[model samples]
Target: MDPALSLDSRVATLSLAGMALAWSVGLTILSIAATGAWEPRVWAVALLATATIVVARETAPLRAPFTAQAHLVVHVLACTAYLLYTNGSEGSAASRWLPWIPIALSLLIVAMCRYRPPREILGAGLLSTSAIALATMPLVAAPMPLHGAPGGALVLTAVLPVMTASVAAACYSRILVANSERWKAQAGYSSAALEPALLSDIERVMYRERVNALSGEAFPFLRRVLDADSISAADRDTARDIAARIRSAMVHEVDRTWLQAAVDSGPTGVHAPVVDDPDACAPMMSGTQRAALRTLISSLGASPRLDRFTISIRATDGTCRGEVWARFRAPYRPPRRRRNADLAVLRVAFSEVTVSTPADQLIVRFSFDHA
Candidate 1:
């Protein structure tokens, strides 16, 4: 696994464990005080239940598809079971309302899970109103208890656990957000470092095309002479076979007249226009150069957002300097040279390649030196 993903998993697990610990400890303390029996027997039993829950929570991390929702359900059930066993409707003020405290904490967990929902504000308002209504029910429905006395202390103890649990839930959410941002930043940096390598590879393919056009032998033994140390066997075979044939076939037929035939001609299968063009402008283009631009434009078709594309070459002045232009629509990235075989070919035909964007328009202009 990637280091970033591993770190995020660990942070998420710790956050869930923290919430579980806060809830378990709060309930344990409240239960001991309300019953007024540090009697070794009952106190030990309550502590044991808290320990069991804390340990169980660690094994069930929050990422098992439905695990988070299931864990919440288990936590809610544990709270209900603990309250019912320790202080069922004994009509005792301390134990009678203990169940509601955990109920409020469970609701806190649910609200945390839906932090960015559109109804979060409304849901929270409703929850706060519900907790107030539920907590005050005992006082309103029954006789008043004396203030600043044992009964008042018991009431405060029941509410304190719910309040502390809310704070812990909020803290857990902030930590999760921070960790997510950290992972995204790391991934972005790694992607940027590979861009230069891709550009260099494109340059290598363009030169290979020129070498192939000059050799009658379909495969060049030139790979060993150029970079025997770093070149792989598979790449050497492809380079030699493809470049030698290209050189032998294209060297004699390529010239100014041959290029003009392509410009005046319509749809020779060598150029696929992104937009319909009756008179293609790339008349002075060499066969390898035309092949290159065609490759670049065809690859753009794979990108769903790239609606239309065009590359036209025009000669200017007495010297047949070629200009290639292309436009790609929004929500698409420029074709990478190494990946788009066509652009790699066209690039060798020109001395310089310039890309520009003004407003929503994307332009790629290729400049050929005087020839």
Candidate 2:
């Protein structure tokens, strides 16, 4: 899977988990208001159901099918309980509509469709239909005559909308899955088609840079060697040394503009510290990774108390490791929320990142594969 798409899935999963938690809280509040008493069992069930769904969402990548199945089962059971309780209670004909509330909440299944298979969506729809039918069975069997309306009318009125929505959602799920697959196929094709052009452009740039560098370093020496009437042994040795140096420099040539920009743009009050490894070449980083590093530097610069900061980077064997260390004039403490948000952005780009604060110095270390 594409890393961007995988990150999006994680974000969606977290959003759904948050929605489930909010729904559970709302249900609990409604129950308490309607009954004028706290129901521990209801609260326990609600929390457990929400927590189970959240855990399943968090672990969905491990076993998507099983997670979807578990989510469907939990939703069905929870909605069934709500339906049964509301239907069994004594209330006006208007109360027949109350059971549909839980059924409506089941629409969250639509969101799940994005990540679940067609079979799972179908199974969920079927199970939901059955559960709704079973919940309304009492009304079907009892045939209560209220406000000149038949019990069958009440059951149908309540069930039809839920069933229709479930079916529509199922169909929509298929469409969504098809569209997603198509989009992914097109993305793959586009990437494949552009690879050669991108590589050609990179090769051209590197070639140009190398040519410029060679001219700048060796042109003077070459001109002198040619201008001299008779080149001495020392001059020949000097030419050889110059050639060796140029080759060595070319082997490690890399752009250092990003590093300079990062340092120069440090917070207004903070002293701009030098790169830890002044001679080390900048690692080739993706746009996403560079953006992440930019954000990290900005965050470090944001703290008013930070008086000094240093950035260190090392690349070896197709991997690059970087560290940022900041020192504050006063006893500085980082805010957890802000720190976490910054780290989240880094983690999206880098393979691994860690932060530590020992005393007043804040240190962040991250690594990524340059290859």
Candidate 3:
């Protein structure tokens, strides 16, 4: 796992800054004891500074982006310089044992994995590895043991970390992309899954409306009856009339489907979605498909220019075809990108789906199987 992810972008942690400083000091000490040379130590300073800068910049949101080629080039040069310094280490295991430059470069690449996509990381890693190897292959001294291979093969050992990091970044990046796309796809369905609450809310409103109707139409008359000083022919006639009207209303409301209730239960009194499913195809659709429609409709509602939308479902042969067509006020309409995504979701949910816009209108036609 990449530990760099844990670092906050707002502030660079003291521990990392301290680690970079210690690295520079350690490499400087090794150069003195091993080669007594100033060249390697100088290169160590450059590499340490470059690596620290990369890490710091990546963590800082307002700083230079990780994709900047300039940073990559500086890092490569520093790595190459360190490789040359390693060559000056004679009669000692300092270069062979520490190999700090390549190690640091590899670690930097790993840290970068948290900041950018895999392809960019792969490119950066590979470029750094190849550049350093090319720069140092001719300048640096080759180890004595080739085992029949060319002397230049030692360059590979110095850069192997970079190569590994490149491949790892590529694989890691692909996973990140795949996961992101999946998240975008599933987000709609998850939001739509809240349809139960919407339906429950609609039911609550319907119950309240029913109660209000009874209170308004019959309750007042019943109160008058309870408080009557004496019964009369007119009272009997009024009670019979109220009884007939309430019975008629109850029967009518009972026969209306839940789909109709949902359709007419728009948030706004005007410009509500119009339904045209004479065959009542909504109740027959799979819950998943129905949820998708609900999500699509809810998303469309966000657009202000939407005058009115109609959900028309018809039975044909053995299948139920549906179309959700919405007309705008005029030239203004929803953006193509957002509309495409909404339609894409319906396309996935339905067996067949098509979308079209014929001047001031957005239409999505689809078909689905029964539950």
Candidate 4:
């Protein structure tokens, strides 16, 4: 699957999971409120169930599929007990009013789940409000010993909304912070992966320019091909094909720019093919070849100027033998004696960095003697 598509799927799944959790909690709370009264034990259990669910909203117990589902089950069971204790009647004033507290509390949990609030804040809010909501029940319900206490009206009207909304705000704030962290991580990965490849390509081009700076001729059509203006598909294909062919043509020339482009365009990541074929060149290469290859690719991949240029190294007998191919972008000149000197040094380092270009294909090969 495409990376972008995979990311979209994950986002959708998280959203659905969050919504389902909220709905389940809300329904349980409503069911409890519809009951008129309940036995002392049953009421206790019902309050416990609500507390369990609300507190676990984003915690390990709540986030895990099995644990969350179990909490919801408990919520429903407690609500059922509340209804049974009340004799299945919904009209009683005590019953009609009791539902408001749990419902509001549940709504707060739902909101936090959807928004993915901070774990610490969510836990604290759930625990604190559950304490308040459960306490309010006896004050409003019958059976004076455990009922008709104090502050029943205030708990229902003012406190519930305020507490729930506070939880919601905390949840929203947490979500934003989490998202910001993810963005920073992604940005770091992109930089570490792509920058090196770009810099590697650029360094190779610069090295070649240094050698040939005295005198060289630039390719005529290179600039037009790289220009950003819109063009037909066919033209684009044609341009790519031509550049590819040019890259192929220069394979025997041992040009740094062309080789750099080839390596940079292949793949990007902290872990990637840095020196083209380090293994193939290993056996013949001295420390210098390895160092040069690493430096060359790193500089080119990080640099904009070398991105469009091509670099090719063809090796024979584990050393640079025949040709080094480089296709410079248009308006960039090739150096005069630079070519000869590069060829000679590459030949001298033949065992370490041999360049070879066969009739039709260009290959960079290295080998390191493990023994």
Candidate 5:
């Protein structure tokens, strides 16, 4: 799976866990403070325990599927159980509206649709709507008096939010999908303007290094050959051989492309080998992407905690995929602010970027088109 998608799943899982924790805590406090039947309080405690267990299991270090269906099932059941217990137990207007709490909670599920597939999102919406409808059936049949309002009206009031929230979720999911496509399109168009500047900067740096190399090695060798006045045939041949070798070296140095030079000069402890197969040639990344990759490499090299790092890139079918693996000398948690800043830049440059921390290892995987 794409690393970006995995990160998104983790984020969604954590968010759901946090929500469940908050809901459980709040429910427990409310049960303690409010004068309610012992049965409802017991049920709330049981539900809270279940929620805690689910969260612990889901948020474990090991990767596991965090399904939208599971989320809807747990929360909907908890909310329904609470509503069933609370309804008609109190005469306050608030008590009559207790059924709406579950619908409101559904919004959290809706918000998470960003991380889910369209079909999953649609399924969750339908499940939530059905759960809300089924949970409120008792109230609809019993016709609970709320300031003399009809039971149907009261049911509609609760149902409307669920319907509205479902529509909103669909719209939000569509927007997220559209924005992702738009960004890729923008990156493709913008790459043309950006590539030259990146290439020029890289060339300038390489040129300076080449100049230094010529002054230190090639020029001195040639000067020695020129200074020798009395030279035998053997000596002249040796000089000619040295001159040819020097010329060849200079030509090779000059012929090295900007990308090759940059890759060769990458920070210590990072290895990017040249893959000879045509299918394995690195894709032509946009200037922005190259810049982002350079920045990320620099940041990783500068980190005192990182002991070793390796990155590999390969291209196939017009797409370039890269993987970065870093090992820490000790357990290290990267500074969130700096890491996020780098990732944000990378996310803009690449179509997808994923970062994973497992035990003492950090893995970053990303892919982008040739553009």
Candidate 6:
């Protein structure tokens, strides 16, 4: 979507989906009231509820990679089936409000699109609405010749308003995302500057990032000095400052261990589960422990399905304790075989290893001497 979705943002998404469910339910009740048919109206309510549950799971802090797409499938099935089932011979009169039914269901499609990617929004909306429209077309025109019959062709007409609105709204969102990316790219000094991938997970520090900042200042200062007629006292002071900072930065980099570099920026830029090591415990782990943790962190980070990650290293008594928590973007646990190798590394690397996976969340606790 807009790319910067934190867990807090999911609350807002769930709220909107909840409201859509409420409104959809209201429509079901109204359809029943209008036609006095109990069973079909009941089915409509049930379908909407089922769709709502799927939506909740998808919008949760954790869900499968297919969860978002599952919304499209479940909703299309529920909404289309409800609209088609009701607008038939048995309940033609009751479904007189069928036009509004399609629109209401379509609103659900639009509502859930917030959690989906911008590029896919329009296609999801169009395809879902089209499925509803097509399903109704075959039966709508021939629903036992009831008065003011809701015809097949008329179903498309009924859905047109929502369809148009969804398209416009989806396009607007796409444009907003495109513009946001453009603005970020323009403002940044390099690709790394604009993209979060460039950020190092370890202490949120990167030598390259620091060098970029340093160079930003150093290069400009050098150019100014070269263009000037003569070097002033301040110019000489500025040059001395840059030289001192450069030397200090080099010395600091030289002192850092290999583990620091490994965690700071390795493959996949050691992606994005928030690293919360406030105790500064990583640098204290033994060399082998660091290697094991590094491998596991990298492997987990490499998965596109990664949702949330937290690594906490604490110092207590004579030893240092470490915990790594990871949650994937799947509704259930990913296959064990995929992680079996990384697990083996963990078992071999640490003296005391404990691992548990509850739901999709993985927690691994280990201890190593502070080196």
TM-scores for candidates 1 onward, in order? 0.34, 0.52, 0.44, 0.25, 0.53, 0.50
Off by over 4 Å in 3: 1-207, 229-237, 251-255, 268-270
- For candidate 5, write residues 1-371 as lDDT tens digits: 11233444555655655665566556555644665555765665466456545544533323223445455555655565556554424443444244425543554555355554555566656665666666566655554454556667766766666667667767766777777889989988898789999899989987887677567756776687689776577766866876787678779776655556676777776644342323433436777777877777777777777777776777867777888777777767655445654665676567667778887777878898765
> Roughly what TM-score does model 2 have, to 2 decimal places?
0.52
The order of the candidates by lDDT, greatest first, is: 3, 6, 2, 5, 1, 4
lDDT of 4 by residue, 43-132 (tens): 544554454444343232112222333434434443444334334333333534343334444443443343333554455455545555
lDDT of 6 by residue, 1-371 (tens): 41123234556556755775787677667766766666766766677667767766655432322244665665565665456455532534433544545555555555555545555767766676776677566555564523455474467565685577568757766766777678877766575564665454533665566768678779899899889999999998988988898878778686655555665657655574455555566777666567668878887888776788877777788677878888877686855546655665566566576778888888878887766
User: lDDT (0-100) at residue 36 of candidate 2?
Assistant: 49
Model 2 agreement with the true structure over 1-371: per-residue lDDT tens digits: 12223334555655655565566666656755665445553644464366446544533432222345465555555555556454444444433234434443454554454555566666766666666666666655553443446667756665665566556766766776778789979988998999999999989988987788778757887888889899999988988887888777765454445667567656676567567655343446787788777777777777778778888888767677888888887667765445554666676577766777777788888887754
Query: Model 2, stretches more than 4 Å misplaced?
Result: 1-77, 83-97, 110-123, 132-162, 167-204, 254-371
Best by lDDT: 3
Give the per-residue lDDT of model 1 (tens digit) for 1-371.
11122323444444554565565557546756776544432443354345334433423222112233343443444444434433323334334344433443444343333232223323433444345445444543444332323555544555455455555554554555577678878877886897789878867965676665445343344544475667677866877776666655565345334334334344433343433222334554565466655555555444444544454454456443333343456645554432323433344445565555554445656665333
What is the lDDT, from 0 to 100, of the residue 215 in candidate 6? 80
Model 5 residue runs over 4 Å out of place are 1-97, 110-123, 142-151, 169-184, 196-296, 304-371
Residue-by-residue lDDT tens digits, candidate 3, 325-348: 888888776565565435544654
**Candidate 4 accuracy as lDDT:** 0.43
lDDT of 5: 0.61
Task: Tell me which of candidates 1 and 5 scores higher on lDDT.
Answer: 5
